[model samples]
Target: MPFYLEIIISVSLLTGGVFLLVGSYGLVRLPDIYMRLHSPTKASTLGITGVLIASMFFQSHLKGFLSIQELLITLFLFITAPVAANMIAKTALHHSNKPAEKTQNQALMDTIRDRESPPSNSIK
Candidate 1:
C-alpha cells in the first residue's frame, strides 16, 4: 500500500471515530428526545459514511478492483437513517413527548400537528 492511501484511510477512520463518539455522547447527555434524536441520525450517518468510504478504498486497493457492497451499504444507510429518524420523532410527538425547555419552534410544531390532523374539508 502507498503512504498516501494509508494516510487517507487513517484520516477517514479517525474522522468516523470522532463523529461516532460525538453521536454517542449526545445520545447520553442531551436533555430531551428531540435533541437526542439529532446526534445519532446526522452525526452517525456522516461517521458511518466515512468508515464505509475507508473500507471501500481499502478493499479496492487490496483487490485491484472497485468494491460495490460498501457503496450499496453507504447508499442504504444515507437513505434510511433520515427516514427512520423522522418516524421515531413523529412517534414521540404522537405520544405527546415534548422537547426541552429552551427549544421553542412553533412553526415546526404547527407542521407536525397539521400532518396529524384531518383535513378541514370533509364530505358529509
Candidate 2:
C-alpha cells in the first residue's frame, strides 16, 4: 500500500522474473539433458523463491501473520526439483543405453563392482 513498499515489491518481482527468464533460456539453449536441468533447478528455483519471499513481505503487514503457504511451496520446490531432474536423467540413461563417457577410473569401478557383486546363490 505504501509507496516504498510498492517499490520494494516491484523490484523483488522484477528480479524474480529476470531469474525465471534466464532459467528458461538455459533450458532452451543447453546442449544436453543433464545440462538443461540447470535452468529449472538453479535459476527457476531462485526466481520462485524471490517471488515468494517478496510476497511474504507484502502480505505480512496487512495480515499480521507471516504466511506459510509461500514458505511451504518453496520447501516443496526445493525437495521435488532435484528428484524430478534426477528421474529425467535416469530415464534418459535407461532408454538411451549408450554408456556415459568413462572419464572416471575404470579400475576403481571394477574393484568396487567385484566387491559388491552378489555371491552366486545357486551352485549349479
How well is each residue in 1-124 modelled by candidate 1, as lDDT tens digits? 9999999999999999999999999999999988898998989888998899999999999999999899899899989998999999888877878778877794587577657455668635
TM-score of predicted structure 1? 0.86
Distance from true location, Cα of 62 in model 1, Å = 1.2
Could you give candidate 2's per-residue lDDT for residues 12-81 as a string of tens digits?
8999999999999999987666577779999999999889978987888679887788889999999999
Worst 10 residues of 2 by lDDT: 97-106
Worst 10 residues of 1 by lDDT: 115-124
Per-model TM values vs. the true structure: 0.86, 0.73
Error of 2 at 7 (Å): 3.2
